[model samples]
Target: MLAMSSNPDSPRVLICDDDAEIREGLVQVFERAGFTAYAAPDVAAMERTLAAKGADLIVMDLMMPGEDGLSATKRLSGKGAPPIIMLSALGDDADRIVGLEIGADDYLAKPCNPRELVARARAVLRRGKDADQPAKSDSVRFAGFRLDVARRELHDPDGVVMPLSAGEFRLLRAFVERPQRVLSREQLLDYAFDNDSEVFDRAVDVQVSRLRKKLERPGIEVIRTVRGEGYLFAVKPTS
Candidate 1:
């Protein structure tokens, strides 16, 4: 079942949870916060709502009777899908990391403050809106690699396309845009993630490591780590 609001101009948020009370409560909260909110009882209904109405963001339960949130989020991971925030009873750091690595834009434990969830949603929406602004170029070239800004794709010098996760794409884009400059973890986080995201410096390091592996060559070092500082994009990029 789906309940929707009439405000077409407001941001659209889809809340999916098996618990009736939780779903309805979130719907009310988002609506009161000036969003055109929709509610779905399960993953199936969530998909239907997304296909029919579209959404600026998705707030999904980590556990459900049929398709779980992790599986569904992995399935939906891509360039154009709406950002997702996973709500789970498992509040451990490992669980949150798993959710993020699987493609959720953010994760929150259940029984959280509704206001915090709303704030996180707004932060994610702001990041999405910023990304949608027109770029000086559709593609950027650096160190025998090409990043397709519009499509969020990366290509090696050999012209083979390298697959990147959403986080990896954002991290790489940040690096390529500011080549030859040392960027602290905080700075990278500001460039690559929502300002209010709970991601830590370790998450930034992990993303940089993953991007480094993809950009690695036999003897060519593209990203250089400065001792006691941060990482630097060793080459200049041209758009």
Candidate 2:
């Protein structure tokens, strides 16, 4: 425990980076912004910190001396894992894809503006909140596949809950919230990612494929690809 603050109102965020300067700088930024920031040098220390003090989010550097951030992300992707913002010099398109593919909630290039970093962190938290949310919905049920908004779970006829990534959950939730409506990838990205930045349609397609595997049940065509239009969730809801 790094001396808990008496003010219990602030959310705690864990910062893991190999660079001392980067660690201290981020700590200062977070604390100045009304957050409790814990710094660690590696994933081992991060694990220790998480064990002692739970975090609302994690800001991690990708290239550490020992186990890299990617390894850490994969390990931490279990159920109810906290949101993560990966920082790295590898800001190439491929690197971002890999980071997102392996459960990272967001990515930021190093030497980034601190304000942008803070904004991205908040955005990630929002996305996390959105994923775990159970908003009022029509309770869509199609061909034995069930989406329960109140439960925030996808269920098969066997009554087994399906695992969904934060991204996958948001995408499906957007569709289930408004069934039989054709949504282009851009619109889906706007709601699911909550980003104004234009996202390629292939990204949505990939997420749909992943979601389909999770919703693998009989007689359900939850996501239908429409030629020259977009994808639609063709199902009526049930109680």
Highest lDDT, which number?
1
Tens-digit lDDT string for candidate 1 (141-229)? 88888888887778899998887766777778778778898998888888989544588776677678878988998888999999878
TM-score of each: 0.89, 0.86
Q: List, residue by residue over 47-153, the lDDT tens digit for candidate 2.
A: 89888888899998999989999999867763566778899999876777777767677778788999888877778777777766656753657668777665566
lDDT of each: 0.85, 0.76
Residue pairs with backbone atoms closer than 3 Å in model 1 (clashes): none
> Which RMSD values do the candidates have, in order?
2.1, 2.7
* Best candidate according to TM-score: 1
Alpha carbon lDDT of residue 104, candidate 1? 83
